[model samples]
Target: MTLDLPLIWAGLIAFAVLAYVVLDGFDLGVGILFPLVQGEANKDEMMNSVAPVWDGNETWLVLGGGGLFAVFPLAYSIIMPALYAPIIIMLLALVFRGVAFEFRWKTRRGQFLWDWAFAFGSTVAAFAQGVALGALVQGIKVEGRAYAGGWWDWLTTFSLFTGAALVVGYALLGATWLILKTEDHVQRRAYTIAFWAAPLTLAMIGVVSLWTPFLHPLYVARWFGWPNILLAIPVPLLVLAAAYILLKGLTERRETSPFLAALSLFVLSFIGIGISFYPNIVPHSVTIWDAAAPDNSLSFLLVGAVVLVPLILGYTGYSYWVFRGKVKAVGGYH
Candidate 1:
């Protein structure tokens, strides 16, 4: 049997992107919630909670993007011109956020500036990502083999809404994370913020879910049409289940459950997206096979990915394990 190298590469890229979102998401959330959190000490705890593994979490982003460029060059070429603005903004925000993460510890007076920088950077990055996602989902304008859209084509009401939704979602993740990894007033505050954030996040998810299907006939058909409806129905049901767990965990004051539940929501949403975009790497325009590089290139890269992905998983898991438990009130990872 001929191995489906393109399909395999697509799955690998999808996993890498999901890993990046699941892992780096909370850390960005921590930054998003930075301003809402009062007191230098509380903020310290927030930063410290994610500091150990935050940078490491971005590895999957590198893997996902690099894999896309290498294994799906055609898709990359089309996507880059289409999303150049948001993608650049996201990268710059991440760079700024990283600089602030380190510099905040070194200076006493300038720390306030760094705090704002971190918050702004995280928010912008998350928003840009959501915008890019919305643009992609709305369908890129492709002419022949190239992106046909002009500059500012990516900016739309739907994309803006998705951007806001991602911000709220990330904030929810941050709040839930704090609930798990802090104590005293910080935890209490997290609970309060989460109480509000949870509902808003779910509402945003619902809006996006409803709004997405209308953007394209394919989406509408894939979601609500005929036999596809049978398969598609479970995503929202599972989202409800996850929401129940998240709310129950929050109400019950369970530390870890809420965080896990939040992650479940993201996972379910991602799966829903995959269901919509199956076979099409660039959506509407390009199939996985259509955009994929030659078989020889994919096979060569798969060998490296096989070795690399596991090492990333191992180290990432190890780091999280090592850093497990609450961050203390005094001092932090700098």
Candidate 2:
């Protein structure tokens, strides 16, 4: 079968972003849950739970960005300039969090300081990405392939809502991860957080669903349209079912059910977004075909990705296999 370069690139972009969400999602969730952890021993256990896999998780972000730059240059050109401030803030937050993750355990005097920095950085990075996502969904002020909006244009009530929603969502992901990786006190605390966080996340999704249609008439029309509406309905229903199952599993203290349910929720939520924003990379601004790279470039990258992506998958699998068990409080960074 012949390949459609645009579809291939789109799939690659989607895979990269989803990988980032699931992989980095756990570490960020750990960060969001940082402040709630009590005692040095607990903190050490939390850190160990993620330390083996956290750095590797960021590979997806790099691939996602690279795919955007190589395959959808137009989207990158428009979005990078429009979100310059938030992008910078997000990068800085990642850097600080990475440093704190390592340095906090190497020293004795300023551990609290690093702990706060790690948590703050994680929250900042997660929220900023949400804001950027909201602004993209809302449509940037584009003029002749460049953004014409002011610095404050990105900061709106909608964006702020998106920011908070992402925090809750990531926290939920973190809680599920804890359920899988920790034991006793930490796992119990995670269950409690998941119980509350899931409902709040659902509320945020409802608000966003209602608000999007009003903010952009096309989205409203898309949902109201016959066949599309039928397809869309199942996504949300699946998510709700997954959320319910997650709560039930947490309540029953089922070992693996909570994480499976949470993972299903993430997958369903991603499908909902993908359905809403199909064909459009920058929402109302540009369609995927309009922003696609030259066919030759896409073909070359496809060749490279076939090799690189599998390697990433293999290494990620190996790391998880190597570290598969409840984390212990070893009291120091390796």
Among the numbered candidates, top TM-score falls to 1
Model 2 residue 4 lDDT? 91
TM-score on alpha carbons, each prediction: 0.98, 0.96
Best-fitting candidate, scored by lDDT = 1
lDDT of 1 by residue, 96-200 (tens): 899998999999989999999999999999999999998998999888899999999899999999999999999999999999899998899999999999999
TM-score of 1: 0.98
List CA RMSD, all candidates: 1.3, 1.8
Off by over 4 Å in 1: 331-334
Worst 10 residues of 2 by lDDT: 325-334
lDDT of 1 at 112: 98
Clash pairs, candidate 2, are none
**Global lDDT of model 1:** 0.92
